[model samples]
Target: MRAIDITAPGGPEVLEWREVPDPRPEQGEVVIEVTAAGVNRADVHQRRGFYDPPPGAPPYPGLEVSGVVAEVGDGVEGFRPGDEVCALLAGGGYAERVAVPWQQLMPVPDGVSPVRAAALPEVACTVWSNVFMLARLRRGETLLVHGGASGIGTFAVQLAKALGSRVVTTVGSAEKARRLTELGADEVVNYREEDFADRLSADVILDIIGAKYLAQNIRALNTGGRMVTIGLQGGAKAELDLGALLTKRASIHGTTLRARPVDEKGAIVRSVVDNVWPLVSAGALRPVVYAEVPMAEAAEAHRMLDSGEHIGKILLVR
Candidate 1:
């Protein structure tokens, strides 16, 4: 098998496709023959040596993949060779095959192509766990999502709307704002032109930009609001205003999907299968794919993600 190997801590050019040892399933794990892999900002971070894979995880950059089962380990039931599935991976999706815990696997939803299914797992698990489960976004509440045109952002916007929330999103361009509005966002703020904190208030905020938006995010939250920060695109360090949080009775949460215990990721995957899959099957939610680059050219895919111009996910197809 061959996988994308990071030659050094640097840019996308460092990602090299090279022959690697074939992975075999461990206890409760399954090996997948990859069809497609989702490209994420985290992959770029990993390539730059900013975020390393968790202990014992593969030293590859991908985090989600859609593939067919090739082998199952002992104790793995419900899946076998030839079964098509998508999985949330801790690492190693940028390969021809990857071994993953069976618990992290999900059957491709009806009507979705296996290639497109690759776009679902990471974004779905991230959004569902943070916005719905952790932040407790409720119907009729306003949910603000930063980086609205991103894979997670696009999914978050549609899912929140489907679940009956009013969606507000911040994007870098008017074109992105228009696209998100058509995707069901009730309000779209162009962050380049206006300040979102002064224009709107939200009961729940799904933020990707960390330090750059911290103070403003607090100010934008409605009383008793909950804000979940999942990415640090802006920076990691920021000064928090406890006084403002106390005055509004607001709460802030920071989370990451990778590096979590397998069982915890399994739980989130199950919840997504139960709560989010139906919406997808019914067409209320959809995977927004911006481009499909060849797996061997993962460096090109990484460049696409870095451009920040893509409206959704960029997939590396086998």
Candidate 2:
């Protein structure tokens, strides 16, 4: 099978396409003939050597994939050969084939394409785990998302809004702000022009940009508000003040979907399949594909994500 290997850590150029051994499913896992893979910011971080796949994963990048089942391992039931499934992978999604644990599998919602299904796992699981499960963002509460045009941001917009939260987003430009509004944000802040901390108040903040927005999150949050930081795209380090945080009873939660305990990830997957998949099938929630690149050109996909000019998700098609 052909898979992407990080030739070395540096830029998108580091992603190398090469022949690798085909995967064989382990117990409780299933082998998938991958049709598409989602490109994520974490893939970029891994490409640059800031992150590494856990043991037994493809040393290459890619965190989620949509594919057809080829084989099912012992103990796995209710799915078999030819099932169209998408999985939230811990790693190893950047290949023609991948082995997924039964626990991480979800059926491709009706009417959702394979490419869109590939885009679903990472951001959907992330948003579900953070905003819904952890933060418990309530309907009618004001929620602000930074980098609102991003994969996670776009999904955050739809899911948060669907659940009744008034969504606001901070984007880099007017064009992106406009795009975010289409994604369902009630308010859009062009971070290049307006200071989000001063202009918009939020009861809950979902932040993809880290350190740079840290202090502002404190200043912008309502009392007892919570901020979930899922990515540090802007920068990881920043100055923080304890006084304001204490005063507002604000809490900043830094989270990553990958590297979570398998059982826990499985639980989130189950809940989302039951709760969110219906919305996707019904057209209430959609996976936004900003660009699609062939698997061999995964680097180009990475470049688009890094450019920050795109809205929604990017996919590496098989």
Candidate 3:
């Protein structure tokens, strides 16, 4: 087996593809022969010596993958060798083979190819958990997503619209705004030209900008709005206005999927399969893939993600 190893704390150049021992399934786990891995900002953080994998997880950087089951361990059921599946992982998807808890694996939705299935797990679970589940975004409500051109952002836009919410998103450019509109966003605000906060108020906000958008996000919330912060790409420190939040009766939540327990992840996976997968299968929601780089050239994939030029997910194919 071969995997992308981070040689040191640094840039994308630190990711190296090298031969590694094959992973074997443990109790309630399954070993997958890698097909493709989803590149994420967390992988970038991992390569730069931040966001270490949880205890007992693989040392690789990837957070999601699509692959074939090669083996299953004790206590695992309902899945077997040769099964085509995509999984949400804590780590190790950037390898030729990875062992994952069986609970996190999901069958590829109908009409989606195995290669593209690699794009679904991470973004689907993230949006479903944060926007729908945590924020309880209801039909007719407005949901605002930051970084609308990103994998999570793109998924969030489509899923919210498919579920009957009015979707508003923030992007870096006009081209991205156009793409988001095509993806079903009712409104797309170019952050470079306008302030999203001044333009609209939302019942729920799927924010990725963290500290930089914290104050503005509060101001953009409707009364009793819920704001969930999942990424800190814009820096991690900021002041919070308690007066504004109190006046609006708004709430803020901070969450990270990678550090969650397997059982918790499994619950989210189950929710996605039940609620989100049907939409994907029925063509109401779609995976947005911007590029597919070879597995060995994962650094190139990382560069693509960092460039902010892509409209959706970038995959590393085996």
Candidate 4:
């Protein structure tokens, strides 16, 4: 199999496609002949040596993939060779093949192509777990999502709206703001020109710009609000105003999907397949892909994501 190997921690240029040993499934796992992989910020972090795969996981950078099942291990049921599926992976998605636990596999939703399915797992699980499950965003409540045009943000906006929540999002430009509003966001804050905290108060805030938005995110929270921080695009350290938090009776929760145990990831995957897939099948939610590049051009895909020139996900296809 050919996989993208990080020669050394640095930039996208360091990614090299090279021959690697084929992966065989362990018990309760299945081997997938990967057709497409989603590019994410975490992949870039791994490529730059900032994030490491969990112990006993693959070393490659991808986190989600779609493909046909090639083999299934002992104890694995409900999947067979030739079955098409998408999966949440811990790593090793930038390859022609990957080994995934059966629990993380989801059948491609009706009317969704396998290529597009590759972009759903990571974003779906991330948003559903953090915003819906953890933050407990209820119907009719205002949910604020930072980085509104991003893979996670795009999915969050649509899913929250479909579940009856009023959505607000922050983006870097007017164009992105318009796009997000069309996707069901009630309000779009142009972060470059306007302060998000000044424009709206939210009952639940899904934030990606960690530290830089910490203080303001608190200020923007409605009383008893819950804020979930999933990314650190804006550095990791910041001072929290305990007084403000106490006054508002608010709480902040920080989370990441990658380092979790397999069973926990499996639970999230199951929740997504059961709850979110139906919305996708009904067209209330959809995968937003910006570009599709050949697997060998993984480096260029990474470069495009780093440039922040794309609105949604960039996929690497076999």
RMSD of each: 0.6, 1.1, 0.7, 0.8
TM for every model, in the order presented, reads 0.99, 0.97, 0.99, 0.99
Whole-model Cα lDDT per candidate?
0.96, 0.89, 0.94, 0.93
User: Model 1 has how many clashing residue pairs?
Assistant: 0
- Residue by residue across 30-129, what tens digits does model 3's lDDT show? 9999899999999998998978999999999899999999999999978999999999999999999999999999999999999999999999999999
lDDT per residue as tens, model 2, 142-232: 9898888888899999998888889988888888888888878899988888788888999888888888888888899999999998888
Clash number for model 4? 0
Better of 1 and 4 by lDDT: 1
| Residue pairs with backbone overlap in model 2 | none
What is the total number of backbone clashes in candidate 2?
Answer: 0
RMSD of 4: 0.8
TM-score of 2: 0.97
Per-residue lDDT tens digits of candidate 1, residues 1-318? Answer: 999999999988999999999999999999999999999999999999999999989998899999999999999978999999999999999999999999999999988999999999999999999999999999999999999999999999999999999999999998898899999999999998999998979999999999999999999999999999999989999999999999999999999999999999999999999999998999998999999999999999988888899999999999
Clashes of each: 0, 0, 0, 0
- On a 0 to 1 TM-score scale, where does candidate 4 land against the true structure? 0.99
